[model samples]
Structures are given as C-alpha cells and as structure tokens.
Target: MLTVMGATGNTGKKVVELLLAAGQQVRALGRSEPRLGALAAQGAEVLAGDPGDAAFLTRAFRGASAVYVMLPADRESPDYHEAQRAKGEAIIQALRESGVRHVVALSSLGADQPEGTGLLVTLHAQEERLKALENTNILLLRPASFFENFLDALPIIQHQGINADAVEPDHAIPMIASRDIAEVAARALVQRDWSGIVVRELLGQRDLSYREATRIFGARLGRPELDYVQLPPEEMRQAMVQAGMSETFAGLYVQMTQAFNEDRVQPRAGRTADNTTPTRFEDFVAGLALDSANP
Candidate 1:
C-alpha cells in the first residue's frame, strides 16, 4: 500500500489519482474530512489527522510499503521554521518505527542551501532529517516555482491586463507545472526498485523572465500589450496584507521574493532529465479559459 500525505492538495491529488488508476492500494491522509471524502469514494483509505501528530502519522504509515510526505506551511505560527522542524522530526520517527521502505518527499529547489533561502530552510531541514534514516530509500522531489501559483494572479490579469510581482521584471526564474511534479512523484513511488536518496529537480521547459512570461500570458489571453510590473518590497507586503494575509506572513513572502530576485533560491545540478509530462503554461491557461467559458 502507498500512503499519500497532503492528499487534498494539487500535487497530492494527482499522485493519489495516478496511483489509484494504476490499481495500487492508496491510503490518503488529510486534515479535512469533507475534502478527503472524494478520495475515499474513489477507493482510497482516507485518514483525517494533523500531519505533525506523531501517533496519527504512525497510524497512517502502518502497513504502507512506501509513503509520499509533504508538510503544509503554517504562516500564522509564531516560529514557522521551528514548527516545520518539529513536524519533520515526527515524520522521521514514524518512518523509522513503521518499517516503510521508501519515502517520496516534496521539497523545493534551493533546499540544499543551508542559509539565505528564507522559508525553504524548513525543506532543507526535513531533507537532512530524512537522510539519517538507515535502510530507507528516499526520493527528494525539488520542483521550481509552480505555474499554478499564477492562478492567484488570474483575477488581476483578467481585469487589468497585467502580471505584477516584487521580483525584478528581467530576472529569469525556473517554473514548473504541479502536474509535472505529480507525474515524477508517481513514477518514483510506483517504481520502488531504486534505493538510497535520489534528488530530482523539475524545471519546466526553460527559465523565462517575468516580462517574457507576461507577453506569453498576454498572447494567450488575446491581449498582446499586457505588461509586467515590479513593486517595491513594502508595496508588495502591503498588497499581500490587504489581500488577507497576516502582516508577518506577508512580510515573509516579500522576503522570499527578495531572495528569488537576488538569485539565491536556485538549485544546483541534481538528477534532472527530460520529464515526459504535459500541461505547460499555455495549455494550463487554455484549460482555464474553457473552465471560465463553461462556468
């Protein structure tokens, strides 16, 4: 049996679906019962519990040959990194006790760097903890900025014909679709032949500057003149706060943008190859158009 944490999330849902379609027995864990009901109906054994709860994780990992692990960040926590570390410790303890042979961890690019990568420090910590497990094969999936992240900018793009951020307009950053990340995760999970820790970096197609991305998005939206704007850090923070993020969380997000803009949050060469996954930005946006038209 394969256990999937964060089963209600974007990548997790795809992973669970792929595993189920392959006739693999899936145990899906999430915090929301209503959200997990769909997966349960789809023939997954759904468990509702907090990921950081040790007893809960132990129960979830029971009888599973391999598990997919991901930690959802708690921006409202007073000490976010500490919370993440504590959660990591719990997951490691459970894995050691449960005799699970393989672990597929959802980490981020730049997770190998010890410093300067603000929120990503938690991912690095988790990777470190996982490495200490003896006889357990671990696959670290380090994906770049998700194209689905731009869904938050959709309202602004549709109304104002602009895509804006705190990062410099000319700076090129790697981006990948979440579907691609799921595809890689599913492949790794189903093929349990590999042992030891394997790191995979999912960089979609190529790196593109925000300006170039704006032009591409504009072309798809039928607004060829759509523009990209770079806001100051404080302005970006305030915008996030006004959009319903806590002040502390908003500030952290601005700091993350600073790190990205300075090129500090990039990954070194790991096990990256040609991933045969579909759903590029244009294709994703085209689906969005269809959804909007049908809705």
Candidate 2:
C-alpha cells in the first residue's frame, strides 16, 4: 500500500490517480473530507486530517509499503518556518515508528542550500531530518520552479495584459510541470528495488526566461506582444498582500524572487536515469489556458 500526503493538491492528486489506475492500493490523506471524496470514489482509502498531526499520520501511514510526503506552506501561520519544521519533525518521527520502507519527498531545486532560498529552507531541513533515518529508502524529488505557479498570475495577466514578478524578464530559469513531478514520484514509489537516500532533479524540457515564456503564452492566447514586468520589492510585497498573503509570507516570496533574479539559484545539469520527465512549456501553457477558460 502507498500512502500519499497532501492528496488533494496538484501533484499528490496526480500521484493518487496514477497509483489507483495501476491497481495499487492507495491511502490519500488531506485536511478536507469533501475534497478527498472524489479520490475515495476512485478507489483510494481517503483519510481526512492534517498531515502534521502525528496521530493522523500514524493511522494513515500504518501498513503502507511506501509514502509520498510534502510539507505544504501555510501562509496564515505566524511562524511559517517553525510550522514547517514541526510538521517535518512529525513526519520523520511517524515514518521511523511505522517501519515504512521508502519515502518520496517533494522538495525544490534550491533545498540543498542552507540559506537564501527562503521558503525552501524548510525543505532543506526536512532532507536533513530524513537523512538520519537508518534503513529507510528516501527519494528526494527536487523539482525546479513549477509551471503551475504561473497559473497564479493568470488573473493579473488577463486583467492587466502583463505578467509581473521581482525577477528580471530576461533571467532564464528551469520550470517543470507538476505532472512531471507526480510522474517521477509515482515511478519512484513503485520501484522497491532502490534503497538509500536518492536526490533527483526534474527539469521540464528547457530553461526559458520570463520574457520568452511571456512570448509563448502570448502566442497561445492570440496576443502577440504580451510582456513580463519586474516589480519593485515593495510592489511585489503589496501585490502578494492584496492576493491575501500575510506580510511575512509576502516578504519571503519577494526574497525568493530576489534570489532568482540575482542568479543565486541556478539549475543543476546532472542527469539521472530517473529524471526523464518530458512535458514542455507550450504543452503546460495550453492546458492552463484551457483550465482557465473552463473555470
């Protein structure tokens, strides 16, 4: 049996669906019952509770052969980093007690760095905590910036005719579709032959600058000259706050963009046999456009 945390989320939902389609037993855990009902209907054992709850995690993870884990950020938390650390500690403790043989952790590209990655520092701490577990196979799927993240910009783009970020328009960065991350996670979970802590980086097809990405998006939307603009840090913070993020969370987001713009987070070039995900930016954009039009 495979237990998936954050099962209602984008990547976790895909992982649950893929596992179910393959006739594998899946326990899907999330904080909401209504959201998990669809997955339950599709042959998943739905567990409704917070993954950070140790009792809930123990119940959800018991008897599972492998597990997929991720510590999702809570924008409303007064101390986001502490919340993440507490949650990560809980998962590690639960995993150690449950005797689960393997874990596929959803981390980011810059999680290896101890500083400067802001929110990703939590994932770095998670990796360190998980590394101390003996006789457990841990797979760290470190994906670059998600193409799905751009979906959050759709409202501004549609209304203002521009995409905004703190990063420069000309700065190229690797972006992967969430589906690719899910695919890699599912593949890793099923392969019980592999053991030890393995780190894999998922880069979609190529790295493209925000300017280039805007051009592609414009072409697909039938707008030829849609562009990306770099907002000042304060402007970025205000925008995030207006979007309902807390001031602290907004500041951290701005810090992340600063790191990206300054090229502090560069894409790693190592190729692993397990890192062969092939979703292109054009394909991802087309799907997002369709989802937006329908929604």
Candidate 3:
C-alpha cells in the first residue's frame, strides 16, 4: 500500500488518482474528511488529521509500503517557517517510527541551498531530515517553479489588466505543471527501484521568461496587449498581505522572487532530457483559458 500526504492538494490528489488507476492500494491523508470523500469513494483509505502531529502521521503511515510526502503551503500561518518546520519534523518522526522503506518527496529546485532562498529553505531542511533515515530509500523530486502559480494572477489580471510580480520580466527560468510532478512521483512510488537517497530535477518543456509567458497567456485570453509589470518588492508584499496572506508568508514570497531575479536559486545539474517534462506552458494555459471560459 502507498500512503499519500496532502491527498486533497494539487499534486497529491493527482498522485492518488494515478495510483488507484494503476490498481495500487492507497491511504490518502488530508486535514479535512469532507475534502477526501471523493478519493475515499474512488477506493482509497482516507484519513483526516493534522499533518503536524507526529502521532497522527504515524498512524497514517503505518502498514504502507511507500509514501508520497510534501510540505503543504499554508498562506495564513502567522509563522510560516515555524509551521513548515513542525510539519517536517512530524513527517520525519513518523517515517522513522512507521519503518516505511521507500519515500517519494516533493521538493523544489533551489532546495540545495541552506539559507537565503526564503520559502525554499524549509524544503532544504526537510531534504536533510529525510536523508538521515537509516534504512529507508528516498527519492527527492526537485521540480521547477510550478506553472499552476500563474493561475493566482488571473484575478489580478482580470481586475487590473496586468500580470505583476517582483521578478525581472525578461529573466527566463524553468517552470513545470504539477501534473508532470505527480506523474513522476507516482511512478517512483510504484517502482521503488532505487536504493538510498536520489535526487531528480524536473524542468518543464523549456525555460521561459515571465514576459514570454504573459504574452502567451494574453494571446490565449484574447487580450494580446496584456502587459507584465515588475512590481517593487515592498508593493508586491503589501499586495499579497492585502489579499489575505500572513505578513510572514508575504515577506518570504517577495524574498523568493528576489532570489529568482538575482539568479541566486537555480538547478544544480542543469537541464537534460531526463529532467525536462513534457507539458508546455502554452498547453497548460490553453486548458486554463477553456476552464475560465466555461466557468
């Protein structure tokens, strides 16, 4: 059996669906029973509880052959870093206690650095904690910035007529769809072919700048004149806070964008055929446009 944490979330839900479709027994964990109802109906054993509670996680991990784990983003947490640390510690403790031999963990491309990467620092620490497990084999999937992140801009674009962020608009970076990440993760969980710790970077179909992506998005939305604005860091942080994110999360988000603009955080191994995923930003935006039109 495979256990999946954050089963109701973006990549986790996809992983659960893929596993069930492949005839694998799955235990899906989430914070809300109601949100997990669909997975339960689809034949997964659903467990709802706090992921930051070690005992709860231990129970959730028990009797599973492998586990798919990720740090669920909580934008409202007052102390976002501390909250992440607590959950990371709980996951590590449960993995040790449950004796799960194989783990597929979702991480980010900039997780190699121990500091100054803002939100990504939590993932770096989690990677280190997972590596300390004595008898377990772990696969650390370091994927690029998610293409899904752009969806958050839909509202701002609709109301303000521009895409805004703290990053340099012309600076190209790797970005991927969460579905590609989930596919790689689900396959790793089923195969369990590697021993010890292994890291794999998942770049998207190609490197793209925010400016180029915005043009594609604008064209898709039938507003080819839409512009991308590089907001001042302070202004961006204030906007994020006004949108209901905690001050801590908003600040960290701005810091991360600064890191990106400075090219301080990047893939260590560079892009290769093995690391490049199939989905293109254009394809992802096409689906997004269709969904918004229908909705």
The TM-scores of all predictions, comma-separated, are 0.90, 0.94, 0.96
lDDT of each: 0.82, 0.85, 0.92
- Of the pair 1 and 2, which is ahead by TM-score? 2
Give the alpha carbon lDDT tens digit for every residue of 21-86 in model 3. 999999999999999999999999999999999999999999999999999988999999999999
The root-mean-square deviation over C-alpha atoms between each candidate and the true structure, in angstroms, is: 2.6, 1.9, 1.5
lDDT of 2: 0.85
lDDT head-to-head 1 vs 3, winner: 3
Q: Taking the tens digit of each residue's C-alpha lDDT, what string does model 2 give over 49-165?
A: 877888789888889999999998888676778889889988988998888989999998888888887777888899999889999999988888888777677788888888888
Q: Give model 1 RMSD, 1 decimal.
A: 2.6
Q: Compare the candidates by lDDT and give the number of the best one.
A: 3
For TM-score, the strongest prediction is 3
Model 3, CA-based lDDT: 0.92
lDDT per residue as tens, model 1, 1-295 = 9999999997999899999999999999999889999999999999999999888999999899889998787766666777788889889989988889999999998888876676787888899999999999999998888877766777767666678789899998777788889888888888886789888777876676888877877776677788999999998888877776667667767877888988887767632456323566777666664346221
